[model samples]
Target: MSTLGWWRLIYAAFAGFLLFHGFSASENAPNYSFMHNATSAPFLSYYDYIVVGGGTAGCPLAATLSHLANVLLLERGGSPYGDPNITKLVNFGASLSDLSPWSPSQRFISTDGVINSRARVLGGGSCLNAGFYTRASPEYIRQAGWDGRLVNQSYEWVEKLVAFEPHLGHWQSAVRNGLLEVGVVPFNGFTFDHINGTKVGGTIFDEQGNRHTAADLLEYANPRGLTVLLYATVQKILFRFRGRRSRPEAYGVIFRDGSGIEHRAYLKYGFKNEIIISAGALGSPQLLMLSGVGPVAHLKAHNIPVVLDQPLVGQGMCDNPMNAVFVPSPIPVEVSLIEVVGITHFGSYIEAASGETFSASVTTTSRNYGMFSPKIGQLSTVPPKQRTPEAIARAVEYLDNLDQAALQGGFILEKIMGPISTGHLELQTRNPDDNPSVTFNYFQHPLDLQRCVQGIQTIGKIVESESFSKFRYDYMSWPGLVNMTEHSPINLLPRHYNSSIPLETFCRDTVMTIWHYHGGCQVSRVVDPDYKVLGVEALRVIDGSTFNYSPGTNPQATVMMLGRYMGVKILRERLGN
Candidate 1:
């Protein structure tokens, strides 16, 4: 074998050993049989409450609700067990690029030309994301009108079981120092609160690099009361109208198992028994529309009979716009995901990750857009996973020449909070598995653009900080390597930009999603303060879909907390406490 081949072989062997040791044993949790595959499980006709989508919100919600009543949790995807791509933190980006029908993430492209993915596993995006965990800001809690004491208790419950204090690696520590050097504010040190300052946040990855997702919260469930069915694709909500002038009521749901078998689950005989849609932002709205609820014209176009002509079913969608600076290191950087964060007063959160490798083969299909990968010029223009063949080749060639050393880098990214810019979601096809057409009109609002500019400038300052100097290259002998000095003082430029493009234009063209998208069943618009769907009965969306704004630095913690919080509230009300 060649000399390069020998080095590659040795490196691979050593890396495998480290990874195996760092990611030991099955996930720690109660040995419960509540989880079952929908394909083989015996059918039940009635459940006190049916929670759809066993994700970040759905898992905790089902677990909490099961304490007092029989709860059936149906997830469209299989359980997130034993899959290295989903369970191991070292393989963070691999699952997102998996284009198989059963992959944990379902890739989609917005009509506005931005690429993104939706979670398909039991744990939802919590299984596919970088695992940063932070509580919602106190201000956010007050704005949402939540009981402060209950919110704190819920967050504590989730943190005890799943969230962990991350052990910062070399790359992460450096990033934190750089953030402080740039005047992000007084260091809050290690804390889960989302205050405006530099702090080391909590992570779902334990010390061994094993991911403890929201699915693990199932251990808290009343084993006899909760039944978890995986690979159960809910087709539509079965609705019935009591009288001609009465409001439509959700009674049951129709779903398909993995083997193409159909089944129906109904609410037990009681006004309190309910059907809850905890499916995510896209899934919840899409499911509602498919079940004959949404704008009348759109439903008519798809030939779905209108159960309710609610015009705002799939409107008011928002995504946090992310812009990043890839800093290629002069030395080896340890692999890490989001650990340290900088909450700025400018309404943007700064975060960093290192040593994440992208699978070139995964990028062959348009459905799988590679994450903040090297060589931006080739990837930014590539169409959706399978949209074009030539583009696929370009995507491949984009990273074909880079060696292992060149891939060793860290990304300093900034994502605007609130993102004032908003868009809407629409059904592309009636199939629930098909991705709904979404348009997150990024930077459409003037204030959003201004925030982007301010965030980008902050990132530039961090890049130029003395602490970050040791990690970056002042000059590179190789062509196309990022010269940190040349791009200083607004280093928002990716590989595609030179000196000609305006910063605002770069913000628009190079715009990407931080994977935080919410709304479409916003509070006071589609659902009431109690999260019950307005103009409907016994139906509620207790997921990110109901949120008007994304919470915290990342929304996973808040979503998980909401699940637990609502579960307690429902149980208390049911028991008349």
Candidate 2:
């Protein structure tokens, strides 16, 4: 058991760090440049561009913008504490299933009432994401509703940072190869999982070295101008309330250092400059709401001042409900089970030379011929408006095929259901530190529920086929759709059998998250197309929160692109010279 003193130590250490490294606006302050002349009207900390939430989007934008402007990055978590929990990327088998040990330092889990994830430590999610690399497809990029400018810019930008190298490690089995050869992994005709650009299995991400994080990418991009201030959390966006007639312009940001000392960091002073918010979908909207920037009704209920009347600030949020199938491989087990599980996880990356992360996933490739493929004929392509009976029927058939294959792949999983998008981030209290009321709201969306069923069905289909006939496995899933729990129920005394559950609900119950949360400060639909919070000036959101909806895959890469694009927009507007 962890002691209360331990928590005190962690808390104290964080506080001390802020007093020393954060702004003081005094001669004794730690703003290296201001030590000689600290008494200034501008205060202890100021910047041309101040980025909050130094995670995936924040770090990159801060780093990029620093090249042309002064950047100050504020994070809520302590820096370089060297906690292995937040440093190493491990999400295979048991690691992925269990959360207690991995995300122990996490302060926030559900971003809003929507996501069910935790990565508040120094490196944030980038420290632990299975560095699956996904280069934006031109088609998918365009589909994001951005003009060609953003997509082309992102591709050009990513290509500069994404330095992919082939992982020459020997494969334990030909599962990935066999799947790729069979057109299951390929989208167009090639695979995108390989960092080395080949049809290989288990692209080793770490490359037997230190892990690469989003912080790494930012630092790598502009090592000179970047100053990462960890343990500093942005409390509010400073606004000069200019009454009802004119738009309230953003002055800068108010943040709390680790020790809980408050300070302000200004964006380059001008009435025209903007305050870019890239603090993930959850954080961005939550901050917006706290600052009286969401639905007037909701803000009033929380006693939060309504800075803006954006009703959709937190609405229209969605994330991909990821389902994982852990396969038990017996093909000459070279590494120990612990080692094997530690490796081979999803999207694991090792930083080589700045491009994408380390070992990446074979994602969005020409080889992936499944639903992610660009092909329309093979999918239930009906738009959100049309959920025709025929479409539902076809989806059910597809579901049957997807679930079986997942099981046959030698999955080392026990729980295969219960993940619902019903989870949402609601204000638990007036306190910012208080955990939000979370509801998965899983099986909430008819179409999303259908997709979950299809994923399970497709995996099952693969298991039933001759592709996995030799690997005999039990039909162990939820009660109605598959089989009964062979062993004891997970942490139970007297478990009841859910035998009569309907197939649809059973399939719904079988759905779980892939842990990809996105779409909070939604774009075009939620915020303005330029990502500005409607009715607010000098304030824009550019992060996973800006996603229109969960893009059906890992959102980090996309969010990074958004941060870059938004930074570029901010740069071009004021400092375009």
Candidate 3:
């Protein structure tokens, strides 16, 4: 209350602001930011490590390795800015192939024309993916020929550094609890094991509700040693025979960027010792063979010089195959961990990594019985066509009618959970400068069909459960707008229809890819137990492509751990025996 007190307080506030500015400025004499192209990007003929494919695996690998070595990370895409479609993590994650700009670009086209575009930009696939850390099932890991050791369970160590925290607001919190009241469970499988279950809750987000990507971790790295070259496409691998009649030695990397300008990422930039390729499954093999290190016949087809007669540069690929089943509900209007607790408990994940809206979810799923989904061919058979538009209209109207009846009977449709699943990743080319040709081959396996059938049946049973006896299903798409395209209530089940509403006899429709594309470069099929390319020297892959079998779940988290593990291996390799 004294005049002297007011004067003292004002002086203290002024002093505090000045002190803050002084400390911030002193940390860096002239702060150089990569976001601003700080100094025209340092390029040279030599660098300690030339990491090709500044992708999900490559970026983190480069950042971590740069802690002790000078590293050059080369990416094929342009800068991370100006692309509102890609930079906005939320929309970017949910963005379907149709809406994605990269989908139709020449960079993503395959010679065989089945569209599959997983990011070709600076941040790599993370830029286009939802941020779930889904790992493999035990069955998946064993099939991939990996010891359980490959799955990292040290969340404290990893999260402490990266802080994989969730960004749950009040609305999201309500959804989480409500999902538990329903039967949906968390997925705690062989991986995504949150050290103490903190990771099990829901969509993983940064403190600001933004998705945290591998690129976001660069701040944790010692920036002085890392050089990220965006818009640079690797053209070839510089290598030679180490001894008379011996395998070739990998020396460095050569790349041609967007402008057709050529540059070399030498191993001498930091300490000039080794190289690593984190270019994912497709890109990695393409680069390897382009530099003369793949199947001889394939290389010749691509008109590339055969450096090594390696037969398996791009074979034995695997990825998680999935089909998202939608259920309509208004009460539970957002994503929920309790709804997916079974998978969460198993580290099977649900991620906000996509940072999209509630309706735009990128979650992985599987049955509790440890079974895969049905093969594509064995799914629903073609039914006779509905006789007329009126008949078709009636059929869809009945689905609406049944939905209402179910609501009156106190239940919801639950989820689609079709019982079948299978994923195969196959390569289509050997061009190092281009993205690899790969396929999901989902629903191609027999058991996949059975799984889908079981899922649908389970959903029917849940909707009919006594737990939902109070609310009206209005089957008119209870949770979400399920009636978006009705025509359900097929008489295949044993449920009684109070109203003798006739089901539409004909309904065969095509569905677009839910964008859960995964598994192209298989683990054992592509490399040996140590993840070596079966025959290449000084090269290894540590990305999603390294997966051995598809768990039909989200594969991003597993891919990240693989990258982290590879970085450790590559770093150890550089240290020498």
Candidate 4:
């Protein structure tokens, strides 16, 4: 046989081996059986530690704790390993827009009328979000009072598994240059540390477009000591009080499985045996309130038994408001997630992604669509009398054109990193299955509006720069339905940028969440510096909800870092590690 023929035969065998191994690995994920489907199984009597909401923080924290103690990690959603919609980078939007009850993302519309979703999967937001990865700013670490050395070490632990250096495509490269041109200065190159500059950073998506989430951290778990139950919705924390003046202690969790059969899992008898609530910002507070740990009046109104009247349990919720400019490229650009970021001095951040088309479902929620028609009354110029049938028909036609343009997709995102405005979360119903009422209260503060305006202006500058000229795009306006080919940055601004009302209107109409919600269970107010609930014993809220303030970047890295740090701290305190 010829050498070439022999090489082909070898290649074929190698491909076959890979195909078989890939199928087997997924079918029997090394620790797959360790993950119990709560519907079919009998609950264990107890564990040394029970971590609620097996998400970004919970997965790692549970894994680490299992190194020394028997740990139970309960998740409301299924594993993300086998889902193509989650593993593929291009399907990032599809994962978030999926409204199915079993979908990893639970979609909700805020009181302010912005559509958003929170992660319902074991990996949590890491499974649903854009794959950008950056370490928390040093200032954030200092403010959180985290051990700096431990925090740095934790970054390494997460990065070893989920982090990757993105292979920037043409459009992403252009974006980097454009950010530099706009004075987001000092090219810091590839580094995970959050620095103020135009620089390439880590990503959760690899060169092959596969995503690695925090769930992968389970590889570090001592499988013998860890039990992960999926499709188990924690209804409330089971609390006990020893004396009249003693603080309520969380001893067990009441959760309903996929079969809707309720079960209880308790902690072993010891002071170190704890229940950690690693549910994200929304879920943590909702769980706390349901468990009767919120404001006294609010709990009483719902007829819930008050365990602790911690007023701050559901307060201080904040999310980064995002705005974007969709530039339709004349040429095809390689698909990419966030590669280069522009850390601006104005308390905002700029990041860009290149892909074939924007998610169709996302376009359906934009202002161009009729989803926001009810809120049109809030607009200053759109009078009530203007709600004519003819006007509606014209608006629909304009939206159709805008959707078509969006499908052509060159996407860039401008996010307000730090906003002063805060919101809150509250239970709409006592049921664990029901989503809580989330109010971002975006643009409620004067500074938030100004910051969003600055972000928009920065986006305009980047797109107008020489770096983006190769794309050759047209501007699409909201109300006026104006399309300009000359690319006038002035046209992008509102008619009255200096005026508070007009700017606020523009912001309200355009602003949407980047889904970096944090701070419901705040550090000093809800949970202490050690991450334990302020008024409770043996219970800690260890997710983004415990963030003292929003970090100045995508928060997955920070959440994972904190998870490891907390895990290590617990180990040292309890096991003398």
Candidate 5:
């Protein structure tokens, strides 16, 4: 079926169901009143706590906080529950490639010429990403100074709602054995805990292939105390100035609703009433900077008024670098995402995606639209001051290349789990609707490049193993268009392994982001151990942005755990339990 046909069918199915049966009033059923368009509703006078960006952390945090106090949760995008494009596991790539302004996954290009997207939906990355889920390593919890017992409990709270063990198919099974052949030792079997070995961990997609995201955690929310506003774009955090030298205190938030109507949600009279910024790595920092809490120099450049002048808000951005080897199978493989992952000894991770490749029709349409034309201008939302035409061109070209490459079948992803290189995010324009200027600075350090090279080498070994040899005829030098001899003995290692320069060049050309961005609002720098932003009162940031370092795994689970941990901490502090 065509995309439009599929959408119409989905809409009809949902509408018919809703018409026949009214929404359920059970605790697990989402409250219809809570999920409303902000433009139509009366302005809320006050909320004991306001959580911005109803995403991975925001959803869970707001739900937890609502138990004790009146809470308002604001999300920029519409609900993810009924969106077939988001709830279906097969439409994962389509979710990210969606270019509509209201798309849950907002596509953007980094300053370093990488095309990527961040979740604008209620469930955040969990709604758009490759659905792989794993718990943070014990070392990660220790490193972050989290109470070991509390962290374990937090993981359980999140897992019980959104996570499930995946049933590995033929291709996934082959991947498992291949990893073992590559010496990624003792299989830990199916489990969620992050251990040093090959293992099949939990996935957000359930047995029926329906994706459960962080938004599902809101099922536990206290309906009487929780109010969720969709399409509520938070423009800035409102603060009350005391004196020239006195610290600024957060009082409320200034936001625009779906119809471009502005609304204010303020903190109630209690001293403990607070505002939490749960936007992801890029978003949290951008919101902070927009609220005048970033480096004074950057704010001045954008002509934004400074409030706190804290220099660390948007700094320390880091993302895992990923490279892939596409193997086009003549025989069809079962559709799957990351079911079995290889935690290699070389500080890298190996995962694979199997199913139909992205169609060639997409590339044809893109080319016809003159993507390469010199007249193709930069995105209008990108301000003239921050626009880099060359970078934009390079990013567009890379996307074109990637689309063309994806037309062929089988997919394997090799990622540098712990990269030494880092990047930063800054505002492009003062407009909250505009995307931030992101610089992942991928492979900037020599060690990062070497790690990627090692990862690719490991993947080559896995593919060459006897377990994967059955699909040998399916091998292609690259995706879509074949560059080398058909099915000739695959060897990326012999040529590139011994030579560093060629390997580096290959990595530079093919390396892309796995979308595991973290550490923009880093602990000890932007927020304290308690997750509160420095030099600010009644404000905290509790998302992936607050990660001290990358958790060295798929971060969706960790991000959810952080929300649970923060929620419990806030409750404990408030109730004096």
Candidate 6:
């Protein structure tokens, strides 16, 4: 079949990835009658399971565990229900720009000089991410020693309520074709299965452009068994030295509410009852270190009482390095998140997004805050609405200098798959809400750098494809005057990389994070295969921090599934199934 004709057939068959016929607007908010303010609630005592950090993995884990066990979920941030910036697709990237204490997204910069964000809301990163949903490759499932049947069932359990097929538009379609044109081969079309091909994956967003986060999966929970406390930050995991021969046991967590009033929640007296840390990559590790479960010397330096003295707690950190080529479009393009992807044979993946609202500001969540700065000078932590004059002037000047054409364009990005270069996290302070000091050491490994070079070249091929010409900007012409028929070749950002700079150097200098970071409390190192923290009883790390390698194009799907899968496994073990 002819290429164009074949693509038409593929599109017709897939219907542009809005593939599932599911429920409508009502699914956006699930009535959580059991949810309460950490401060307003009466003092709580114990739960069958105490799940810390009500995030992507934490939500599903808590919800599933609540089927038969009483679960207490503590989240440091507010709810995502009324946050339009998080729920609406048109306002997708806006949440990350908000630096206020109440913002759903908390921006963090790695000591490696890469800017990143952590989810502060109940839904976690899902509330701040591009909302793409794709399962881990089958190889990933096998390597993790996951029960295939249960794994598939767990993915479906989450998907049935949350995941949806995405609607493909002109830009996404062009990207789909461009991926095939560049020999990323085999038009697998619309699928949630992770495979080596160009395909449209699932999204958490439904047809109405409203995101369905892991928080929505709480609808499956038994409300009577689940108590979710919003705006509660867990200060530390309280441990007991049972005897000289026994390891320290995690019995409960000490958390502070929004009013800064301390509260204690403990685990029920049962062998199966546990305290699970579902904090993201950063949070999980930081929580562990703060609770005196990390490296002994480091914890001692911080004057924290040693609990486990586990050296691997904050080690093996990694973040996928992302680079992009912004293709300026002549006409108005539809705004979209990550809807289509090209999974290549090599250790890399290609994805694209159009019409993202780009903003510049210094995210002040870390001591290394100036690293991610776009030279806007110093800004106050008071947020934009109440910014000082000097800060306001700096932001205004930066915005005024932005090229109008750049805002009208789309970005075709490539991120190195499963970056081999690893770094470590250290506690900057004992404060639970403070950002942890981390370094991803992007492209530190020669193989990772080579993969990045290959990925960028693949993107270059996509840019040079005939399919992308329809949207390529006419660089020769002035801004807003680009003629669609006569366009210039799209290139990487000049300030980032060019013909003069070597690709390896470009990979190092322009490296940014796709936020697929994992490890720290890695499996086989800190946690067992069952995700239980080694040397510590009744305590586990169930989030992205436990991952050795990030699964699929986005780790969110696997992370969510892990929550459900592990919860089910724990329940079965309780039943002796």
Better of 1 and 5 by TM-score: 1
Tens-place lDDT digits, model 4, residues 1-577: 4463354335334433443344432343444446766664465569999999888999889889989999999998777776666776755566654555666778776676665678888799898777889998888888778789999999899999999998777889899989899898999999898999888989998777777888988989998899888778899999999999999999999887765667899999986899999989888999999999999998998999999899988888887887655566666676676788998888778887665433333313443211122222111123223434454445445444543433343556677876678888888999877789978777678877787778777877887799888764544423223553222111133434466656556566657567787888988899888988998899999999877566757889988878888999999999762
In model 1, where do residues sit more than 4 Å from their true spots? 1-30, 42-44, 356-371, 374-378, 381-393, 475-499
**Model 6 residue 283 CA deviation in Å:** 1.0
Candidates ranked by TM-score: 1, 6, 5, 4, 2, 3
Better structure of 1 and 2 per TM-score? 1
In model 2, how large is the Cα lDDT of residue 78? 46
lDDT digits (tens) for residues 410-514 of candidate 5: 567678876788888889999887899988788899988888888888888887899887654543443433533322211123234656546666677655667
> Which whole-number lDDT from 0 to 100 does residue 313 have in model 3?
62
Model 6 misplaced stretches (Cα beyond 4 Å): 1-28, 356-406, 474-498
Candidate 1 clash figure, as a count: 5
- Rank candidates, lDDT, best first: 1, 6, 5, 4, 2, 3
Clashing pairs in 5: 408-480
TM-score of each: 0.89, 0.68, 0.66, 0.85, 0.85, 0.86
Candidate 6 lowest-lDDT run of ten: 364-373
**Per-candidate RMSD, Å:** 7.6, 12.1, 12.9, 9.6, 6.9, 11.1
Off by over 4 Å in 2: 1-43, 89-115, 147-174, 177-204, 220-224, 325-424, 465-484, 488-503
What Cα-based lDDT does every candidate model obtain?
A: 0.79, 0.46, 0.45, 0.74, 0.75, 0.78
**Candidate 6: RMSD to truth:** 11.1
lDDT of candidate 6 over 155-230, digit per residue (tens): 9999998899998999889999999998998999889999898999999989988888988888989999999988
The number of the candidate with the highest TM-score is: 1
Model 2 lDDT, residue 9, Cα: 40
